[model samples]
Target: MKEFIYCWKDLEPISHIPSYVSLTFIACVLTCVGFLYYATNTLSGEKNNAPVITTTFVAIWLFIITILSLQGFFLDFDFRPPKLFIFLGILMLIIIGLFAFPRTRAIIAQMPITTLTYLHIVRVPVEIVLWWLFIHGAVAESMTFQGVNYDILSGISAPFAGLFLVGMKSKSKLAAIIWNVLTLGLLVNIVSRAIQATPYFHNPLMDAQPNIAVFYFPYVLLPLFVVPVVFFCHIASFYQLIFIKEEEE
Candidate 1:
């Protein structure tokens, strides 16, 4: 496994990154799974097998991405549309599809606003991982909080927002909307910076180095799983806050 991972010219050796970094990221992934499971279970209320189906589907998707990343499929940027872009496009489509389908919309409507808000707390550890990656030369400094990335603020404020702003009150609903929008902006800011820091479009504003860590395993999960989940939560929050009546909440 080490050999296959290191064979990629763009990847750093396993020894270069601390074990805790990977462990922490894996923990974050598990936390995401827990969030999704809780949401699905809450919606299901044991009336059906939807939670199991949802978890199985997500696990299979993660497994496929893990296998592909280990095989270095996304590192092949020589093509007209780089595999990285292709992968990102697929993730975007999956998120869009959830919004597009009415069945999924019903599921999203049932997701607890508090859970969606608190789920962002996972980003706090993710920001720490980004810093570790920066120090290890796996990512550009611009992707960390020390640089242009303000996404950490969203993570830090998540708990507070979840605790105070998520309620049935009209003012609370509006505040939730504002919170989700601001955090969603932060998410977009970091994702755009990450794209610019990549090899295909290395903007000088980011750093002297390109952000290549995400092409590797575990790290690839950042873009593949974590960011999309965060994006989904924000959009889901918006749908509920804007469309669902205050009495419904």
Candidate 2:
């Protein structure tokens, strides 16, 4: 377990942004615009199955990546690199079931089981591993926090992901509103904190800023990408739950 820390630390890819207004920045910006477009439509209460799943998966990945981005949170223990074997194993089982029996996919596809947020349960272990990595210095500082501390936002993948799952599963418009509001609230709050901490983001350039590492906005607002998708998921999930409720009624 102790030796794993070294491996994890090295594997925490440090690919630099190279130029602030570089290709990576352009890509991230485009991605953000795309997210806003799709999420805006979804928030308007459009029901689309493919978009919902795609958004949910993107939320999961973004949340996971953010967690992975943090560095040196853990200093006292030996951290190990996490392998997603368990997830893969479970995923394989789910896949086999889907192929073996049509009902399996049907049952799995059922949405909004309840307020318990089961739709994102598959991601629980990933968050756990990330937490352990943070606790042991396996991961490093984020473009968001610059220097991370043990706090609500440090191990954000879980609760934030939970928020996404919750909003997606809810049937109330109030929930969707709350989800979007929180998404922006949390995003702005964290970005402000990161900017305050990191000199690079002292004066952020909106779309016209020079090509810089923190210029892409992910370093400032790590949740920007995930939040919209998650917020949209909330709308889709709510729509789903309402439909399910009416069917039961």
Candidate 3:
């Protein structure tokens, strides 16, 4: 365990943290924006609300970025734990509220399940970014696939499963359900470990180096924006499976 924690010690830190980190950060942001556009368009259908949808998406991103910049929220590790927990708690409540409210539920139910499934493909690049961060000593080793994380598999299989289920018009809802459940489990596993890896929680099982990178600019966007969106995608999938009916084969 100790060896795994200090595995990156031998490797030299990247010479240009800003340049490479900025590239990866831009990639993540663009990927997330693309997914949101696809999802919003899928839900909006032919309502001609694409402009509104796009505006709303940009507005939300701007809001988050503005807050991050103004407050320097990422630099302070002392207050990060409570802030993150509170943000997560509120996010969960909002997700639950969206599902529970009749109007919002109907809106979400209109989204294509296949699109939700495909959205998880973003996780592939997310894992890759995590690996890069691990190498740079920005995050802990345990957070990557090389250590305890295996969430990347879900991202890899998502395209195939989505294609098979949607393209083939398969009636085996059970298969889709199983895949969603398994992937959801993987998401939860990594998220739990990530929380533990934070300096505040500091689980002994995790690496000695706490996950400090996520609290900084650009990288902080991962936890605030990307991770929550992925969680919502999973929840939205489950909701569709339970209440929304599939077409007859």
Candidate 4:
């Protein structure tokens, strides 16, 4: 077994001084506070309104939370699960039901659109933390450098630079389609690794631990959300137009 050394420059345990639990608690408190403030304002029927979902604000929030989450993972080698995990879990269940049940589709579609909009606000950040854990080469870490360097994109200011480009329009439609095809191809690489691991894919880093149990196919939503939702959601839903035509100014 390789000896593990702690790099104190980037990480500190939440338990020792300011624990991850404490930060989670603070985030929860602030979340509730923010919700209450909005609820009170809405009930008062003020002219100035805050929608339950704010796309631009939520996008920025997701990115900020993701960066902060990396710190917690580095400190403990485990992405600190949220204090509001139950809420998020319920939200996930509703989304899954909406997506999977055709009979529920029409009814679910009628729900306040803002709910899904803001829910993704919360979802994106959580996924980012999970992604960081796998990259950090933790017990469930997949592909990491030296089993310590969590960041595959070490030099770049925004490791997720591709995120910005994925949904944006390019001069080349041919190129755009090609990029999507290439992405789907890349995911196939995991299949080979999965086969090699066989009946069960265990985390080599941890004895008697099965990393593949919770994060199996279909449940392996990290990649799907990355390319399909974040990247392509805007493309089909926001970019190309089949019905609505833009009028010349």
Rate residue 103 of model 3 by lDDT. 72
**Tens digit of lDDT per residue, candidate 4, span 82-201?**
222332354345445544665433233322222212222332333334344344332233322323222322113122222332223322334434533443243333333332222133
Q: How many clashes (backbone N, Cα, C below 3 Å) per candidate? A: 0, 13, 0, 2
Q: Enumerate residue pairs that collide in model 3.
A: none
Please identify model 1 stretches exceeding 4 Å from their true place.
1-15, 44-46, 167-171, 204-206
1 or 4: which has the higher TM-score? 1
| lDDT of each candidate versus the true structure | 0.83, 0.36, 0.72, 0.31
Per-residue CA lDDT of model 2 for 1-249, tens digit only, reads 345434433443224323332334335434544543453334322454545564565567545534643433322233332222232234335334443565433332353323223222222332233233233332223322333322234234334445553444534445544543554454445444433432222333331121122212243222334223333344444444444444441
User: Where does model 3 exceed 4 Å of error?
Assistant: 1-18, 44-58, 69-71, 203-205, 247-249
Candidate 3 to truth, TM: 0.83
lDDT of 3 at 200: 65
For every candidate, C-alpha RMSD to the true structure in Å: 3.7, 16.2, 4.9, 12.2
Per-model TM values vs. the true structure: 0.91, 0.27, 0.83, 0.30
Which 10-residue window in model 4 sums to the lowest lDDT? Answer: 240-249
